[model samples]
Target: MRKALALAATLGTLAMTRALMRDRHVPLPTALPGRRETLSAPQVGTVAYYASPEGSGRPILLIHSINAAASAYETRPLYLHYRENRPVYALDLPGFGFSDRSRRRYTPRLMADAIHAVAAEIRARHGGETIDAIALSLSCSYLAKACLARPADYATIGLISPTGFDGRLSGEGPPDGHRGREILRDVLDRPLIGPLLFSGLASKVSIRFFLEKTFGATKIDEGLLDYAYATAHQPGAEHAPYCFIAGHLFPTDSTLLYDRLKLPVWMVHGQRGDFVDYRLAPRFAERPNWRIDSLPTGALPQFERLRAVTDCYDGFLASIRPSSPRG
Candidate 1:
């Protein structure tokens, strides 16, 4: 019995040592390559955003997905192309990027509220009562909710590779209550381990591996890998992934809110996107006001096919007009 007990203890120690070693060598991304801007709003956490001052028209608010590599920088291709025609505002959602990280729980409601607060600030600065909002992946849920909560505040809504469309609506219980809730709580409560795991999932090597398997293309832009790595390693970035995995960074069922929304709604998704589910199109199509744009590219359509995505966005914007004149 003593010999068996000693062997088990030795194996446990070895396993722990291996985990610690792997963590120490984990490669993280650097800060996003761009100018950092801060926006302060009442009732919402201080928002960190990236902008290109070289554009015109009603400023467009771009919300990236909640992931380690997710940020306004991830949307750089779109921002660079669209900035000349419209001032682009890409924000690092509350707990991501350089934004506040003190909060322990992030929810779609909280994120939507943050978007509302940021919109208020943008209206104050740009003299516009309403703005065009674009969201990618997980961010789509939060932005959708924000638009639903106050339909008149947003002139148009854009969704890229959106989630939360499992033939359900917003406020519905998440699928796999036990597993999802446990994952959420584990991510939020265990900060250090959560970030490490999330970052590892988003690592360049991991991204490349997944891209090859999903897209059947191994030739990823080296610069993209570098950017992703650097952004994941930023000082507070370690906590951003945890918030995202916890599902507190974005709401899960904003699609159900679609029925109540009256704004021009456009959704774009890559057929081969990582988060793609057959249910997304059919679910959103059930709504009369929503329009869908399917891309032949991958989940990171902006990076995979920049010009095609830009052209699609430009055409969409041209087809719609602000419901009301800006102040």
Candidate 2:
């Protein structure tokens, strides 16, 4: 009788596990208020973005961070705030959002090129107007790479709660060298355990847990939470997250890339959260082209202190005189 009870319990647990692992085909709602469009980028196909190109002056390009449930919603505050002041555009990077989530190694180059493609499209539409690009969290590196590759395409760039200042990553390796562990990457790509692993990570509770760490507070934006959960449940949602966890999404020489940037840069970071290490930032802060500001809220400060974030960023932009797009 005891053995039968043990067998019954084992079967029940397996049944529950199977149920959780089942992929739910759900409609992914747009993260912002605008018409969604796509760009056929090389290497990374069908990049989706939200556009409100009605406002005047130079266009602004927004990029969101990378993680399990990341999307344009990560930049929603900045997008919505800037839409009325100027033309605002937000992109979904290679793996996470409405972009290509196929089974492939999502690299930093692929992500950066997606930014470039979108910027090129924007320039084509607005008489080759130079853009002011801004990004959040880990995305700072990719935007920096894009800016470095095509400095003339951008007027200035903004980074909020960016990665690369942390002591653990030196980011001084050879070109395109990633911090991904081969063994771990292979393990994550395995058949049997891979799906189950991603299922657990993409769970609503799991996303909220990580988001809380990022916000550095118990209270987080509920809309973001809902969108994150829904997007995470969509088809091919787990592909990019596996690469992210295995560290394939990050390049080894991230800091070196930032140090090489010559364009006017605005960086705003939070004092409270899982990512707050700007010790190396003083090096750039001493330079005339860099402006670093610290906020009281967590990593995504725009949500908690939107006015402060916008004001600081606006001040930075106002400081830079407008230049001819082709000059």
Report, for every candidate in turn, its global Cα lDDT versus the true structure.
0.66, 0.86
Best by lDDT: 2
Worst 10 contiguous positions by lDDT, candidate 1: 171-180
Root-mean-square deviation of each candidate, in angstroms? 4.8, 3.2
The TM-score, computed over Cα atoms with residue i paired to residue i, of candidate 2 is 0.92
For model 2, residues 1-327, the per-residue Cα lDDT tens digits are 999999998897778656755664667888999879998966878999999999999999999999988999989989999998899999999876788888888889888989999999999989999999999988899998888888889889999998887787648788767777768878978764677887888788998998899899999998888888888887788788888888888889889988898778999999987877777888788877789999989999999999999999999988875542221
- Local distance difference test, candidate 2: 0.86
Please provide, for model 1 over 1-327, each residue's C-alpha lDDT reduced to its tens digit, 9 standing for 90 to 100: 999999998897677645634543435432333456787765567888776645667888888776655556667677777776776777877766667755455566667778888777677777765788888877777787777777667788888877766443334555212113546666445534554565567667886676554443566556666665655555555555565555455443455555456777778777763555647567667554667877787677887888877777778777765452221
Model 1: lDDT of residue 211: 51
> Clash number for model 1?
12
Residue 228 lDDT in model 1? 59
Candidate 1 residues lying further than 4 Å off, grouped into runs, are 1-35, 167-171, 174-199, 210-216, 249-252, 286-288, 321-327
